[model samples]
Target: MAICKILFFLLALCIWCGKCDVFYKQVGDEVSMKCGVDSNSNIEWKFNGVLILTIDGKSGNRRKGLSHIVLKASASGDILKVPRLETRDSGNYFCRQSGKQHIVHVVSVFVKPGPVLLQSSDAELHCDITGDPNKEVQWLRPNGQTYNEKNQVIHLKSVTSNEAGQWTCLVKDDLKLSVTLTVVGLQTTAVNASKGDDIELPCSLPQSVFQRVVGGTWKAGHLPKVSFPTLTNTPSKILHWNGKDLSKVNFTTGQLSTNFDVTLKNVQSTDEGTFVCTVEFDGEVRLSVETTLRVVDKHSGKTKQHLGCTLFIRTLSFILYGLKLWIWIAVGASSVFLIGLIIVIGVVIQRNKRMKKRVRKLRSMRQPLTDKDYCQCINSSYNNCYSVIEVLQHLFF
Candidate 1:
């Protein structure tokens, strides 16, 4: 039973040390790791299971191998230092002590190209890791902003100068690496040229980083994202225009320095958009500037956009004026009809009252009318009767 218990304890120890502690650092950074043991413990340090150093437990003395140029061991055998780390120094480090299990430390040193960009350019920053692809990656900006991205890449569209600073990459919320970004001003200009006329779009890098330009490109419309042309053995003096050879573009170079000013031979309406000039340096560094082109028709002496707007405005105004005049005319006709109807109705009501009074008088008169009554009726106008029907013979007929 005692032997069985010992075997179970050993199995548990192996399971406990199955996973290793991961550390992330950038190239040229230093790292220090610890061994979970005492100062006088008989610690044996190995890299990838190869014995590199052995420390004596009695005297606390350390013996390192010939490959220990940048690797340092503590006098107490409890700490190890790796300074000025490079890509080659990334691997698993093991600490084995007497009568104890192995402890593993995984070191990942990565290198990233620094991005020197122009304002209003699109860019993407990557947090590259060598080991543990499942590790969660996060980005922390200089302005106390955090982004928990699962893909380990942060895309910045239309990057401005305000976003330039040291950006830190956090892995598993424990490992951190920082990368610095530099932003420069991009000169912008608007050129208004007539269609079928020659126009120039000027673009240039900052004076500080101009001389290091190895290759360049001029892209029209929307700028591409990290897409560069294939370079030759030597630095390309000819700039790539619209993903094609430079023959199609009319470019002029300065006598002293390189200039990216492009002249359109015959500007057209299709050429009216943003044109971006990107200059490439060694180590995948790039800078870009942009300018806008506005095309106008030479015959009309106005842009097509302006002409269309003016036409629309004039037509709308005419329609509104005509509608207003028609509305007033309808209102006047309705008022005249209503007033005439009211006058006719009043005349009818007065005639009706006079007829009622004459009927009542005729009914009250005697059959044999007196001459005084007949004479009185003739003297008055017969507006209430159709004809003079006061005589008995006319009434009988």
Candidate 2:
């Protein structure tokens, strides 16, 4: 009891200071909360400081707090319940006892779907509840299977007959609220395509939902542009609705003849927007299917610039590598030529020295034979010849 009083004091202090525990809930949900005190403890519940009920533990008597709103309290007065929550039910809740406050709860209520939901379109279901913020809650699908997440929004893509039903949001042993989803109207799709690529936007309805499509026109960004003749068993090309030629777009029917698919040829950046396909029924009732187109350009200016820089760097590297190789080759060739020239000069100088020595030796050998030796041999021969001539003359006389 003392701990409970302390906790309640802190909670009341937080509320008094304009900071309190908050609960997020959707309208039409059932709300249940605990007062954080003993079940038998005599407690009073207040909404926005107006006494809604005061339970007498001894007498088990119940009194109304506000004349307009009806709130339910458990027999022990420790639990508060609201059968059908509404937007007007959103406010601060207080649990009080003799001059002491034990808890403060702030409820915020909202509506997810306004009245009805469109068929063949995207929808969301939010499971917001009132209680401990950290507490977990689960959603029970229409098929009776439990969703794996807690306190999450369930996204319904291309809602169809299978999705139109009641869904339950369960807060473990605390609260359970059910909401029915009804789907009507045309189907919508979201398309993503790169610029200059082709994309198809589908517009179709199940035969069970819609009988026949009398006539329809296509609108881009809500401006009527393309139309086709009342579809027959055979699909045909779509022409400009206002006689202005639209060369880039075409239309065809699906195999079942229920599909009105629009093909955009070579999508451009200007084509990125919402496209609506309106189909008329027998009674002039028109339903529109929407397709949201997102055009992506891979060759952006920044990307081109980056690619250009990379190419330039590669080209420069190749050129420099070639120049470096040629420079080395030229240097090697010049060194070889200079070495050959020096070897030739050295050989020529050595040959010239040898020739000069040979000439000097020849000149020495050819020096005129010594004069004395040559004269002695010639005198001897001349004297002998004179003697022989004198003897021949004496014999003749």
Candidate 3:
């Protein structure tokens, strides 16, 4: 029975140790690894067959552990801690308990940064993964180059302009990483500013490469160099281009301004030209982008945009005026119709009352009062009371 028990324990050990788990950590982070179970007999940790830590309870064997490592015993389990983990810490760590045929735990550590590395130097992209036994990785660069290897990192060195694109990393369904590598350098995006308003001639560089930027310059057509800076530190330059006075250019005052973009203050009509931006960085010069500065008269009303806006306003005003006229005409016509209807109704009501009064008076008198006094209608110049037109002939007869 004891032999069978020993065999069973060995089988369990083989099974548990066969299962390897992946744990990801960057270089400077603290990591805690659990032994999964606490043994009363002995507990030991190893890195690639090298004995790292041992806790012996039976014979009281105590040994010095790795530097910067702390072993913690708790109700849950035994914990191995690293205060500040390094790149060398990346490997398989084995934890074992004494008299146990099965391994307690297997932890595989990896060191790398997060995705999307933007830098002036070479970029290193990482594929974060866990729970894969094969530990295989596939990499695809922006230049359509492919790599299939066990390594999880793709180191790109001496990157150039055309190399700026997407990089893909994959471990099938278990892991995947997509990263964009943007090599920051000279470039221009168009912007519009009024003649008198200030403008920024764009030249942008990443903050990580700030040391490489020696200086920047701006020029107008083939004329003499328009602007150059006196200072070594700041990105701004004093205007010297054209026959234009240097006093007109002002350094936009800021202690920590990033953009090398120049500002032309109180711009005039002569300032219109194809302005070019040339930047010198890291002992090399590159011409970046050109902006067309078209300065017009400062008059507010005559500009093309203002004219289009004014025409739109006039069209809208005419529509509103026509609508108002139609509405007023409809209202006046309705009022006239309403007044005429009211007058006709009042005349009918008065005629009905007079007819009723005449019937009652005739029944009471039983004699001819006067033809003119029996009925009254004032439709015309005639003032006779018996003025029913259909009965006028009978009354006369």
Which segments of model 2 are wrong by more than 4 Å?
1-45, 48-111, 114-116, 130-134, 185-397
Give the per-residue lDDT of model 2 (tens digit) for 5-75: 54455665766875455455556555675667676678787765777788777777777767234543333
Highest lDDT scorer: 2
TM-score of 2: 0.32
Candidate with better lDDT, 1 vs 2: 2
The alpha-carbon lDDT assigned to residue 189 of candidate 3 equals 58
Candidate number that wins on lDDT, 2 or 3: 2
For model 1, residues 1-397, the per-residue Cα lDDT tens digits are: 4533433444355557663454567666666767778877787776544567788888766677655532543433577777676655555566776233332223342223336665555667877554434446777887869865655667776667777888887765566777777777545567777778778777654544322456666677542432323322233454333333343356543231335566666777877888876666654556677778787777884466675775555444453445754456677899999999999999999999987887667656636545554433444656533234544434343
Q: How far is candidate 2 from the true structure (C-alpha RMSD, Å)?
A: 28.6
Residue 91 in model 1: lDDT: 55
Model 3 TM-score? 0.46
| The candidate that achieves the highest TM-score relative to the unseen native structure | 3
- As a whole number from 0 to 100, the lDDT of residue 354 in candidate 2 is 86
TM-score for each predicted model, relative to the true structure = 0.43, 0.32, 0.46
Q: Residue 255 lDDT in model 3?
A: 38
Model 3 clash tally, residue pairs: 3
Question: How far in Å is the alpha carbon of 139 misplaced in model 3?
Answer: 1.5
